[model samples]
Target: MSKFEQQLNQQLHDLAKEKAPQRDLWRGIELGIEHQHDTGTVPQNRHRRLAAVAASVALVVSLSWYGIQQTSVPATDHPTGQALVKALSNQHEQQKQALLVQYTDAPAMTENWEAQLAELDEAASAIKAALKEDPNNGALLRMLQQVHQQQITLIERVHAPQWQQI
Candidate 1:
């Protein structure tokens, strides 16, 4: 079970009405029993259990909503940075999927593509390192590859007339 569940269970069990104010426990029980009695009678533990369930649901929903908000925000495009980010995203997904499966790669990919891919791979490595130091920044991580791509490609192609072909 999760920490939330564990805490809830402890709270439920530790509701000892003894030395710690009988009035409060009685009030809770009275309120619970009144609700139960008004609803034409229910089991003693039902209200307590319901309260715990509602708390758990609220906690889970809050966490899920936060996650959705985080993932739903769009990243801004920065040309080569965008391309590099796309590649990194592909790799991240592959890494996640690898936990559940295995795959094999073809033997004869091009050396030229390898060098281009390596530049991206290096940038991704640096971005990941930065991310480890600051995990809250999805944009920084996302911008990593694309930023380097623009710099590297521009330096290599700036003198050539055919850069427009890029």
Candidate 2:
């Protein structure tokens, strides 16, 4: 290497050393943040409070819904399954009425929902006839109850607002 080139390289290395800041830049950033808070432009505490209230309202609403669902069915059980029949019938009727009200003017997603509901009702009727012949038949009783539940579910699915395309 030439002496002049070596000296130039040494000078570049000396100039490449780290330069210190003349003032604390962190203090400027801290003050800017503090000014925003003081001016109420950024409500740091308000955000937390709003988030907490939303969470609390969501929790309360979910709990209330759960409680309502839990209380819908009575705990008393009839030995002959009469209470079960009564409960299923009442629930089915209520759901049917609600669906009718909701879908009286609403179009169904499926074209054959009425036929499907009719088929389920027919099955329920056949099961009910068998149940009348042998009221103690657990299998027949369960089948009838299942049919009722299916009808309710089908009605709910067809009449749900979310299912409406518009």
Candidate 3:
């Protein structure tokens, strides 16, 4: 071994022979325990407070979620509702036609895409019929919009998948 390693070993031997300084730790621990007992407050109280806070937070979150669901779409009268529906339908048709023209020669990934589109169209028609009866129904309007979006997403996915580009 080199001189540095020999010196390190000698230091380690000297440390091993030395005795540790002694102190009474039990008195301090006992004092702390007595003080805690006198205060009448335990760790369980902290846990209870944490649980209560968690419950309140959960309740607030649930209420906010419920409120959002209830007010997602605003109610509208017959004329305004009909106009909105017509506008959305016109835009969807234009987009669909444009996409079809763009992918005329490209083959779709799935053979049943046309059937899926037909199903979504039928659903849209049903929602429209429901809207005619209750023009101010916000939920129905939301459903119609969701179905239209789904149709567009399906068309896009079938024509040009993200994985295909990679």
Best by TM-score: 3
Residue 38 of model 1, lDDT score: 81
Q: Write the per-residue lDDT of candidate 1 for residues 60-147, one digit (tens) a residue.
A: 9999998898688755433234455456667655653452233123222233644554676677677767766665566886476465
Question: Which residue window of length 10 is worst by lDDT in model 1?
Answer: 99-108
What overall lDDT goes with each candidate model?
A: 0.60, 0.79, 0.88
Superior by TM-score: candidate 2 or candidate 3: 3
Q: Lowest lDDT 10-mer window, candidate 2?
A: 75-84
Q: Itemize residue pairs with steric clashes in candidate 3.
A: none
Sorted on lDDT, highest at the top, how do the candidates line up? 3, 2, 1
Ranking according to TM-score, highest score first: 3, 2, 1
RMSD over all Cα atoms, model 3 = 17.0
TM-score of every model?
0.26, 0.45, 0.52
C-alpha lDDT (0 to 100) for residue 71 of candidate 2: 88
